[model samples]
Target: MASKESVCDSYLSLKPEKATIIEIIRSLFSSDLENERFIESSEEGKLERKWIILVSVIVQWVFLYIRVPLAKIGDVLQKWLNLISINGGLLMLFLNWLRGKVVEPDSLSSRSVLGNLDTRIELDKSIKPENTRYKAVLSIMAAKLSYENKDLVQSVVNHHWKMKFIGFYNFWNGYQGRDSTQAFLFKDTQSDPNLIVVAFRGTAPFNADAWRIDFDISWCQFNKVGKTHGGFMKALGMQPENRWPLELENDDQHSQFAYYTIRKMLKDLLQEDENAKFILTGHSLGGALAVLFAGVLAMHDCEYAWLLERLEGVYTFGQPRVGDEKFGEFMKEKFRNHDVRYMRYVYNNDLVPRVPFDDKALLFEHFGPTLYYNSCYGGKVLKEEPNKNYFSLRWFIPNRLNAVWELIRSFILPLVKGSEYREGWFMRLWRVAGLVFPGIPDHIPQDYVNLTRLGTLLLPKETPKVQHSE
Candidate 1:
């Protein structure tokens, strides 16, 4: 059995349920965090750090109360959306309902709420295999599809993308003590030796577990690699025994760890076809996992250097900061040494990319230039996206005005780009939400899909001029 308590030496773990009202308020001024049963830390926490912990616990407490109802609402909404699709349209749905001939949606064939919001299952036709943007386009598509069901994934991969569906998995999280992480693998035949793409699923809209993980400020330190998000590491399937062992013996009976299992699969496949390369990608939380996956491979470089050599790239969209400054330096060195391409994409005002608070209080930071696209689909390579920390009084009206432009762009894009760029009714509603919360709607895969197809800037070639790298 994996013992969660014994996982890391220097760490802070939050248990909101174990806290009291007095303790929660007192934590802000308290230095001895280890003294509190609700807070677990290797050493005394700074007053500023405890403030973050207080916010985290409070948010988690609220989530615990709303998790079930939120999930129910999402379930009902997804089913309703699937009904509209299954019946062929909203009008058709109504007409069929009057005649008592409405079609029921099959759960296996239906899309998740994230999928229903965008509803584009096909890859961009204009982006060819020869195009430099092809992998990034394919990556965003895979990241979008990752939100859908397994059958939907197979259908899209086989019928539309003309790819082989490897498998869909629900991997185990040791800390969560159950299967909490999800990812899927497929092989793209468009390339000569066939490229295998492993896309980790991003945070689901209704999943409280994922939301809690995202908000958790807990961290664990590695010898020379620096500290990383404890929630993300756990979600990536870190085991309690020695954290990350190169190989595990007689592990057949135990639940599969995402890192080890995916690593083994890629190793075997690469060995079978020597010329094949692979890419890791995801959107939002998935994006964090994708980059960290690459980071971990680099960490075990001596034993698994072959995987790094065969890795084509890592592309992430609306991805949050994963680790500290030192960790960022470590990964940058690894990428530079391995000649691996790491493209972190941020569509205008996407809040997810700017999180886990990169400040003096929190150690999380995003490394490398961001391939940022504004609402007009204008692209730039920047060291950091504007409004690096999202909550800003300075950007308040400007952000909402930008949101208004996005809403207008939703109407104009179809005329300028094509019918393919037209926003769906549900997607437009999400854009409305942007008026209130500027970046939340922008975090959706819809804008990401549009930007990849319409954005002008080609990466790497356009990146090195130091366009916005202040």
Candidate 2:
């Protein structure tokens, strides 16, 4: 019999890395002239006889202890056991055959060459910036309170695009403050009045800058409350813990707030001396708000239509399902001037993407192409173990068990429940286990990969040169 090391050596000599999987299998099964004579001469036949005797004795003892009296029952049990043993032995033989065939001699060389070539090309491209007609600016808007603190506001806006992070408080203060708020404050002061990008951040303590983006735009909160109104803070949902509002604020309040702010910005932009286009983008809660505001703009007719006609586009990231199906369809149709592209990024089997909304009345009827990446796969391991085999029985058995368990929970459990299984105690446990297990790969969101690809493609093309005048 050939030693394990000798078998491995022989397999590696075949240059499995350069060959296809089928070719590798063929090579392993092909008769080798040198090894044939040794196998024929070996006393492995005697060893096989001894193993069969041992198995027979064990089977006889098991049958005696079980107290099965009939000779026919004993004979049937023996036949079943023999069949199981034969199949198990065949499985092991096949696995060993694969192991010998699948060794890749030049894997390291191939991987290294590819890595080096990619790195060199990327390095060369990063050094140079391209000049393009359109400048891409990422505006992160803040919620109400951030606008009040001038220092915080200044810090956020000081960087690129003079981005301002506004919150509900800022909106309230801006509109209802001691002095009447100017409707289109930022729009009045932009350098290139032709192109504008407006993005909103959702909820309180808004900090859009927390997420990395290229540009920043000054944001002003549009207070969405009127008299017979609770205090400004209460309407904005900033009341102290003890004073939480008992009733949910109407969608109209939120819609009006977003509409007023957007209208003011548009009026100021159109009123400016130069002609420019505008684009709107937001994520999550902000995305819902952006859609609402866009719908309102469409409703106001030509004053807004003429302005939006010059609009470039709208991109909402991870936006919840919002508006009735008909309203959603109406909004998309009415906004003919701009293309409303909604991008939802889900992470690791997250349930947030399935927000409650009428499917038949979905505003954005079309779902864009989905791009997948393996970032979350193989779990985010900092280091790989040395001398670890990618395919091993030890690794496969547990993985197979895990796969079976997941299929039962994800597929079977739902059938029993008569509905889709929500992530509850049992689901959470499995997710936690998946995180720990190396065999089970993690799931990554398609949007995250798409964004990265977009960044790579665009980043090399241009670098925004920030200009400052003291």
Instruction: List per-prediction Cα lDDT, in the order shown.
Output: 0.83, 0.32
lDDT of 1: 0.83
| TM-score computed on alpha carbons, candidate 1 | 0.93
- True lDDT of residue 88, candidate 2: 48
Per-residue error for 304 in candidate 1, Å, reads 0.2
Best by the TM-score measure:
1
Per-candidate TM equals 0.93, 0.37
Q: Which tens-of-lDDT digit does each residue in 1-470 have in candidate 2?
A: 11111011001011111333453344345444223221221222322222222232233233333332443453454344333333344465467456774222232122111111111111111221132212222322321211123443334344423433332223432112211111112221233554455655432111212110101011111112100111121222222221222222564443234345455556665567347666665544444455545544554443456655665555444444443334544554655435444332322222222342223311112222221112222211111121122244555555455545553454454465434232333234444565445232222112222233233222222221212111
The clash count of every prediction, one per candidate, is: 0, 22
Give the per-residue Cα lDDT of candidate 1 at 397: 95
lDDT of 1 by residue, 5-43 (tens): 223556777777677677777876766666778877775
